[model samples]
Target: MEIHPLHPTFGAEITGVDIGRPIDDDTFARIRQAFEEHALLLFRDQDLDDEKQVAFSERFGPLEKTFSQNPAGGTLFARQSNLDIKTGETIPIEDARMVYQRANMLWHTDSSFKRVPSLCSLLSARIVPPEGGNTDFADMRAAYDALPDATRQRLEGLAAEHSIAHSRAQVDPNLLSDYQKSIEAPPVKQLMVRANPVTGRKALFIGAHCSHVVGWPEEEGKRFVRHLMETAITPDICYSHQWREGDIVVWDNRSVLHKATPYDSKKYKRLMQRTTVAGDQPTVMQ
Candidate 1:
């Protein structure tokens, strides 16, 4: 497999490999190394069913079982689409399902609210919209590197609280049903800076799921995190992927933040399946 840089600094488009089938140890090692170095990898023109996708994703680590807030909750897959999971019919724009999906429009890292966070997320496009529906990714390692010396030093030991409820509430206050709220993962603290276990590269860990810095005053922490988010999500370090059918992209949840762009869901059908790899350990203990 050959890897080509998709962005000047981080994301890459990997070619000459078929992820739909089992891969040997040597090839998988190179793929994992590429993932550690690049943070994001895209493979095109590959057909993958759910079984195949899960098989390939397991090569990374253990798959995360989605939580109660999503339609795909309790399953290994986090379904992204406008159609009903069972009926397969278009959902209304104002429906709770659509509101839940709107949360995806905000820039966030996958499963950061979990105690262990996530290692990476692999999303496969089974169907694509005719226009719009792009996915944008920002390189957090580059973002961290670009910070001024004083600011970098100040952030060295800081920890932030992350929660799924906090992020979903940003989109809609009433989005989560009572049952969902009852089962939601409580807020957990994560180090504001994370270092890759393999490559030893450091990255800032702020995103939508991050509510506030752990010990700071509430509003002050929010304001500070917003400022850091602004610094990290700038266009200079971002790459937008306009997906095609049979495309699969894997992004490091530990080192990058991604968001879904708008699309005309009323006029088209789009289905994307995502599987998240659980992080090996917590960045910080509660």
Candidate 2:
């Protein structure tokens, strides 16, 4: 397989290997290495169904079972679509499901609220809208490298709090029920900076789910988190992907932030399936 860089610093497109089918050990090893070097990898014109996608995703690690907040619930897949799963009819715009989807437009890393967080996420586009629903990714490693010496030093030895409820509340105050908030996904702490085990590249771990720093005063910590997000998401470090059918994008949750762009859900159809690879260990012991 040949790997071609898609962005100046962080993304690449891999060709000459079909992920729909099983790959040999050597090929999979190279793919894993590419994923570590480049925070994002894109594969185009590939056919993959749920079974195939799950199989390929497990090759990296054990998958995270989706939480009850999503329609898919206890399943391995986190479904992103405008249609109702069972009937396949368009969901009304006022529905809570659509409102939940709006939170995704905010820049965040996947599964950061979980105790184990996530190693990576694989999203496959089964159906694409005619226009407008792109995914934007920011290179946190590059962003960390660009930070001033003092900011980098400040980030070290600090941990931040993360929660799914924290991010969803930004869209609507009652977006998540008490059970969903306290049971399915509760607040957890993660290191403010993370270093890749393979490459030893450190990246800032702040995102929407990151509510505040563990020990700082609430408002102060929130302001600091916002500042870090603004610093990391500048245009130069960002790459936007306009997806096509049969396209699968794999991104590292530890060193990257991604958000969904707006699409006209009322006029078109879109379905994307995501499988998350569970992180092997926590960033810091709670």
lDDT for model 2 comes to: 0.93
RMSD after Cα superposition, model 1: 1.1
Whole-model Cα lDDT per candidate? 0.92, 0.93
Off by over 4 Å in 2: none
Over 150-243, each residue of candidate 2 has an lDDT whose tens digit, in order, gives 9999998999999999999999989899998998888999998999999999988888899888999999999999888877678999999999
* Model 1 steric clash total: 0
TM-score of 1: 0.97
Candidate 2 minimal-lDDT segment of 10 residues:
65-74
Which residue pairs clash in candidate 1? none
Against the true structure, whose lDDT is highest? 2
TM-score of 2: 0.99
The superposed Cα distance between candidate 2 and the true structure at residue 267, in angstroms, equals 0.3
